[model samples]
Target: MKFIDSAGVEFNCPVTFTGTVTTTPSSPATASYMVKRWVSPTITQADLTGGQASQSVNLTGFPGGVVLAASYLQTTATSSSSNGGTTGATLSLGISGSTQAYLATGANVLGAAARLSNAAGTLLGTYRASDVPQVTITATGGSPDLAHLTLSCRAVVYYLEVTAES
Candidate 1:
């Protein structure tokens, strides 16, 4: 049973989930994983050349009220051209907004109306329909022959809920 407003008003709190990623250095240079609406064994498309590389994955469609904590690179490359290299990756997470993309604080947080965050546990920004979250990886450190290596990731999902109003 539930209450109503006017004739029978009802509101939904929202569904949210959060998580992080960590990378490290390894041999053969291969990475693949899935998160949110993204699946593993995927490839990233090159912006300049429109070429696809087998070292990227994307997640989509959140059930609202989801928040991502953090994403650390234990051992991974930022670009496919520099895959399997000694360099580190600088990753960026983008959230969906009404007409623009918002960057998250700590990791990636998906909430009602589509929002993002990376502030360790705070809401970084919000998004609306037609907008989607994007993750970018850049390379740093000593460069190695990463052309032959593959990319992959291990995604972790988190869930939280609010029982009563305070």
Candidate 2:
């Protein structure tokens, strides 16, 4: 089912999902996962468990709302440049974004320094130019290959508004 308002008003319409990055190359870079929309401000990761990959979310508390679009990314880390593409190595991860602007891009997001925080709100990674936001994975020239780069991502959308009827 589609997530649309009968009154046709523009709402923030936010969604979220969590999944491990697939090791296979057949996996799409941006997998369209589904989410359960809630009227409340917060939705836990457990809310999306057992749901299908790229499935359209169903609204419960927010019954009237519709699920429109989804956005997320997956990345795999590669061996250091010194290695001739043999082993996988873990590297420091960073992400930058605007706490204020969800659509911020490039230096704009980077400048804001809005980054990913640990569950406690501690900064685990800082957003950098190399880390692709929503779709990209940053790498150093030819030294590191992002082949099978694995990372977790969460996407959120804000519902702009809602109407009683479509």
Candidate 3:
């Protein structure tokens, strides 16, 4: 069997078992069966624009029963000389209705880059079947002096569906 995901990634399920059996009867009936299944990883990305106090990305159509294996946020900032003597910015990622999963503060100087992930700090474990994962980005303690800043967020999800056989 072959499985395809929303990203068009293809995965082949190799049959692990094959067998034939016959039922006892005057005239015996025979049946053949094969079993094949696998788990595949899927990834989706959401881009966020900076300079705003708060930004949110809605992960609509996110499959249920799938695990939110991992997630991370990357950000880039370009500050002009005019930003001199201004405080740096602190960025954080969190669920729409939950506390921050990770936080990164940019350098006070111009042209600074920052990357943050929940991997070691506060891991966002597998999501619940009834949970809708909405990632939110919040920027605080930054001076409006910054020329431009941009943020991009990405999420990796894993899931597998089992086929029932009888």
Q: Candidates 2 and 3: which is better by lDDT? A: 3
**Candidate 1, overall lDDT?**
0.32
**lDDT for each candidate structure:** 0.32, 0.26, 0.39
Candidates, ranked, lDDT: 3, 1, 2
Return the top candidate by TM-score. Answer: 3
- Model 2 lDDT on a 0 to 1 scale: 0.26
RMSD of each: 16.8, 18.6, 12.2
Per residue, candidate 2 scores C-alpha lDDT tens digits across 1-166 of 2333447744566634376423322232443333332122222223333212211112223222332222211111211322343123221221233221222212211112223322211121222122222222232333444432223323333222222332
Alpha-carbon shift of residue 11 in model 1 (angstroms):
38
TM-score per prediction, in order, is 0.31, 0.23, 0.40
Q: Per model, how many backbone clashes are there? A: 43, 29, 0
Q: Which stretches in model 3 have alpha-carbon errors above 4 Å?
A: 1-52, 74-93, 99-115, 119-123, 142-148, 158-166
Tens digit per residue, CA lDDT, model 3, 29-106: 334222222222221122545344455555555445433335444443442233333334433433456535422222
Q: How does model 1 score by TM-score?
A: 0.31
RMSD of 1: 16.8
Per-residue lDDT for 70 in model 2? 22
Q: Give the alpha carbon lDDT tens digit for every residue of 66-166 in model 1.
A: 33423322112333333434344333444423111222223311111122233232332221223234444343435532243334332222322212223
